[model samples]
Target chain A: MITKDELLQIIYKAVADFNSMQDVDEQLAQQANQVLFSRPGFTKEGLLDSMGLVNFLVTLDDWLDQQESAQSLHFDISDALENKEEALLTIDSLANYILLKNKKV
Target chain B: MSIKNSHILILSDTNQSNFSSYLSKYIKDAKVVTTPFNQLMQVLINPTHAVWQQHYALIIFWANPKSLFPDLEKTLIGKHEMLHVKNFFLRLIDKAERVLFTGFENYPNGFYSQFENISSHNRYALNMMLTSISMESPGVVSYLPGYYSPVVKGLHAVSEDLWYLSKTAWHRTVTDRMASFVADMWKQWHGLSVKLIITDLDDTLWGGIVGDDGWEQLRLGGHDAVGESFSDTQQQLLIWKKRGILLAIASKNDEETALQAIDRHPEMKLRKADFSTWRINWEDKALNIQSIITELNIGAQHTLFMDDNPVERYRVAQAFPDMIVPNLPANKLEVPAFLRSLSCIPATGVLTNEDMHRAELYVAEQQRKNSMTAFSGIDEWIQSLNTVVSIEKLSHQNLTRAAQLLNKTNQMNLRTRRLSEDALWNWSQTPGQAFYTAHVHDKFGDAGLTGLIGVSIHDDELFVEDFVLSCRVMGRGIEETLMNFIISLMTEWQLSNVKVACLLTPKNKPCRDFFSRYLLSDSHEWVFDSKARFVVSGIQCNVIDFN
Candidate 1:
């Protein structure tokens, strides 16, 4: 099961101008937490779970690719994800995997 | 920070501010050279010493770029310059793993217009040709549309859309069509199919069961609504048999009654000879399925089981779940659509000679299966085919098909390796690396690009870095031909040692028997002792040299 907070983090990474992880986390916490956001108990750990992360990463990937500016931000998260047995199991995992496989990591 | 950094060697006028800030932020290792674009020809003249030091992963040229083009006055000159740039681009692609051509002049249509006016159908055609060429040759191209403001620097990066507009429709249709075309070709190329379809012979093939209805009352074939529908459906199944997809009977009925029904019925499209296998016994569905899979030398996954009985469908689904057991349509009217849906996988692009002989080859395989009952030894079984091996060097066209086989093939594959379109070109364009893939053809038919081997030459030694064969042709001495062919090349090259390694994968156990004779062990062992052993092989074989 996925939580709202993880979904928010994925969206944040994809769209937000926030440069740091802390900024991303804050935006997620604020945007999430309400049951209206879909899926209750919106915790960070719930968001990072395998299925949750994959959905998050796919959304983030599409958002990043759509951005017209900021060619400098590297989307290299592959090496960290490659350690997993199934390379595409999670959102963060896939985002990282694509980055590394393309040598962006 | 590490991710953002790229070692870029830009040969643009440094005075330009367009992508400088963006490059600084995105790329960690930036070597912004002030040299003009034309000066790049001078820089690459002494590639080994001068350009080697830069160790640039990518190079960008930032300018009004139109300034370099003195005029489009002489259309021929512009064309010649484009050709020169294209050739130079190819050379760069061969040298570098990845290359991008961006920052054409800032005019709205300036970038695309140059290539568009140069006698091509559309921008996409030119772009796809270039992209496919780069893809085939181990490089890629990207364009950077100019940035209007500092805030949106590096905003208009060239990717698939800007590079080629026509690819969207071409890829969608091409990929879908290609999949089915490849599937059909695979059936023909292999020659032998699963021994039987083992379909239920009642409402499954026709509108009614013969056991329940009298022969005259039973519906099948030609005129009068449902009868014609049954005839059309039965003819479609016959099409499968003509392609060497064998039919089988697994009807739950008295043997005499079923035989009589098939023999006496006027509308029946399928005759007695159409079935090479049958299981019309009053046994459990599970037992019949197991027998069919065993007798066919096929897995349940390869078999397509059809039955009209809901209880039977459920039982078979539970018993042999791997078999393709499509549900009987709820409407019963949409049966043809349901059947056609199964033909979705493609069967085109590249086909081996064996593909044309597939149906006949399957018939031959049946003969072999029967002869096996009389013959005792493995040698006798193999000797019957008078098998031939044709090994060849990888050419420009077969590369895509060869790499595809390498990616999908398992069971007999030595190392379960997966390579992308880009990586295959990298191997081809990389200097001193001899990439060879083989196509196997015998008495049956041509199995196109069945084997692939990648050899890298370092110093004077030849190395078998990667080798794999399609599992479909495994058991036949195809492995022997591959290894011996490599050794022949090693001998011709005058290399003392031919280094080989078999990377282990669970499904690749068949390769263990292969390396036993050639590599001396089923484990990993590096054969090269020194750099002198790394030499290119000049050996040739008459077996697969068609050209």
Candidate 2:
């Protein structure tokens, strides 16, 4: 089973990878344990472009799927991002949401 | 730093947004613009498309032939489609400064001939055709096998969900590595590559230290596993040497002892002759590396250091942060493969005849230096050597190497201009501008094509846009010889005054120093009277007719 701290670290790693790809102005990626602070119009304002969202979500989901505890439990990843109208609010919210879906936890 | 005025276009038939993101991350500075998804054919066949209006420094055709040719299973239809693609691609290559195309089909329609799978052969055929076209393309088009390296036989390369949701063919885990490979490919094309590899001797190069174990006890090639692995490391370094990477030693040992081990070892894959230079003394490895770098006249960023000792590796890394100091795998058995996988190793691309004789060229430079003691003055030494220089109008035969020199020559460059072969040729086509290449041969040996000077005429004052000479032939009166040719060119044009467009850069102080003789009072500009003699004695020049 994955712990909350471990999951946050993975997300932070994905953020670092994301920041490496993005310019300074486009770096909405905060440090680990730091709030992501995404709103509805974040993508519209060009803080994070369409591709950045795809890369971030895909990177996060790939790590979650690789966890041994999540092997049998198919993650409800579509709902994780398909709530597209309401994008990521904070780093903690997504961590809490993933933990809820992880039955082993 | 971003390459000045580098505009890259990603032309893909599949959704390459992730590839673009990864590319932007990897290349960092270049302005990357990705076209709409699956619109490659429209951009390729349509000249009026927005892509054609603006020129690109590089164009990547990331493709998915499965989508491009849905009729691949049908023989006649596929044949027609292939013929159409071939014809238009040739036209497309004419428009790009340099083009990087898909070397493999990333997401084949089906696995190739696996377990009763019949239709996948067409995808394999598609791959083979792309490779064939990339090989024979008249322009600078190279198929990209870079991204495919980190991928293990296409395993985990693609995810069905990502493909369905976003249409990105490559998995996110793999894109970062892919981006690095692409960046290396681009950097190598500009002659920015790791030129020298400094390796440690003790446990890094062999199984045991030469001074302690003695030559007879050192583990190199033999029947044993450890001995074979040690020899394997040497073989890998030898391959890099054959690829034009100069090998040098930086170890804490007696120079003669190390050389003796290299000379006397029965199965040593590397020889004393293979190393261009070395600093095998009991000093700080970083200082030793710096000495070798000074002797070789290459930047630290263009060097790679390999050492098994953690402290030595860290020390060198701290000394030269830009140098590629790879941490050899802890397991000795894995060392060879890990060394082979380093991205800083010289790319197989851009290898010319000059590359094959690069070490010999360095040795020739050393010999020229060695004989310096025999002469009273530098001029006398230069006069002693019978030097002949051939200046040719830019032609296809020498265009590739000329561009390489224009990019590689940093110290002797006037403007520090870097351009691809096609870009250089394109600039020459503009009115009042011409570029000439200089090839030098002396009593010592051939220096190949080592100099370039681009000039433009504006109101009778010949403005020298670029004046570059390779370091190998520097200080040998080649600069004066090239300058003399330029002055003669001015006389032929009936122009009396000449101005150099020299830009002072951190590495280009040598250029400013050389042009100081012609510097106008107080200003950085160098204006010369073309009527005055500017010839180097004991040198013969041949300038081809320029159109």
Candidate 3:
């Protein structure tokens, strides 16, 4: 399970990391999330619509790939974000997603 | 830097050959992952594919022709593709360093159509949008027009023309226009102001050697024919001087002859008064240029040197690669047009008060130097001008100048980090971000927006992320005023142990000594916490109102 806030944190960090950002602390990270998510529902897709999300995701993926003994997994977090069917959405979900996918090996 | 950890994910359907493999050979840092073109939406949605994001620095998005537009079943011509491709480019402009347009090699029949379509009226709008984005962000979006490469010959048709025409039109076009435009989209980028135009007097400015030919016989100053062309060039140079470009002449001739021709010749437009410096000596031209650069306290890149003599031009070019050496036409008739193009048209915006006072400022500097030679102490020199510092919290009015200072102020810049307008806007929106501008004025002139600093607060720790001051205002005690102001702000807020870090840059050695100089504080790279110490000095006086 991954919550929107957690997903956003990862996304924000990813974007910052991709940019070689040195001092994007929690405060700036929160603002970045707000900027992307603050708009009305109409612009929610706009937040992740263009290169911003792509760059962020790409950066996150690169960092994760650098981890020793990297793992890959699939976990359905859409249920948590969209349906609100699950309450747990944190950095743990991201870790578990990789763990679960690697379990197939 | 080996890109071993990097990966590139290409989303394309064409089986023409694995372009990813081709890219892989060139780019070895990241593994290349090529997925079938239509699977974009699915791949993005798939949580498993997130691995691609973690492994790659770049994502080459090759649009799948089939899934993107199903209605156009037949091979879409370049125009039709471009109409759609334009949307695709706009969509991805935010993500990539540059988007390379390709298709001519594989599909030549439709290439011209795509090129023409992209070059149509919509091209201007696209260029405008790209330029607008560049203005806003810096280094974030660049479109490699399809015509840039033979295999991808479409959008570049216009860009190439635009690049060439800008020079022909006598406009100071953007340098590294497309790449810089994109880089500017994400960061603040700077351009050198062509302040001083240094020229040779004999063949460069007018036709004849004044030392040998004398005023009357010297092929200058007349409406007859060749002399008329010489006067035209002089008039153009005079126009530039009036517009605030500093004019200087370095001629190896008897100074009296030049004075006589300029003073007595009826057709002469450029006179002795127009030049800021006249190095009319038999010394080496290169040495004279070196003296000019030192006297102005500007970089070689900011000076444009012109000489009709090929050997002289070669000598200067070899010595200073950065100095602009426009080709001097062999024929005198072409001199006027060449000089006309050499005139600097100031950046596309309104001129500032400081810009208008630049000539006065330089003159004041000369006066200050002459006084310094007569004065006994350094303090006497500084005190002579009655310098005053005025600090103002950042505002919209001076944001552009603030950005300029952050990007261009090198020697005294602490952290030496360049930021884009979008980044600044984002920072303003962020919590705990503080920005301020400082203006210094003395008896000489107003050094406008002389300094800028950006600070961020996290928990109890305050971070001085950027501190920069313009070179023009460096010698004055402005930095002390800025540091004192920062400490005063912290005292007012009751914040403790304020930490300031100075990042090393190619041109920022002066900044490394900042804290040590005025504050007598130690700096370290460890994550700054509340325990850090910043001793505040209590000496203040004479605050001038610059607002």
Query: Which candidate number would show the highest DockQ if scored against the true structure?
Result: 2
Better of 2 and 3 by TM-score: 2
Regarding DockQ, does 1 or 2 come out ahead?
A: 2
lDDT of 1 by residue, B423-481 (tens): 67577668767667776555554555677877777677778766787655666666666
Q: lDDT of candidate 3 vs native? A: 0.55
Model 1, B201: alpha-carbon shift in Å? 2.1
Residue B505 lDDT in candidate 1? 67
How do all the candidates rank in terms of TM-score, highest first? 2, 3, 1
Candidate 2 accuracy as lDDT: 0.75
What TM value does chain B of candidate 3 have?
0.66
Chain A vs native chain A, TM-score per candidate: 0.34, 0.65, 0.36
Write candidate 3's Cα lDDT for B335-438 as tens digits. 78766544233423334455555666677667767777776876566667677667766676776667656766778887766554445656755768878777
* DockQ of candidate 3 (2 decimals): 0.01
Docking class of 2: acceptable
Clash pairs, candidate 2, are: none
DockQ of each: 0.04, 0.38, 0.01
Candidate 2 wrongly placed segments (more than 4 Å): A1-33, A40-50, A69-74, A84-87, A101-105, B1-3, B76-80, B106-121, B145-155, B374-376, B422-434, B504-506, B520-522, B535-547
In candidate 1, what are the lDDT values of residues A1-105, reduced to their tens digit?
A: 223344345545653432221123333322422111122343323334332233233335455565443233344323323344333334343434444445533
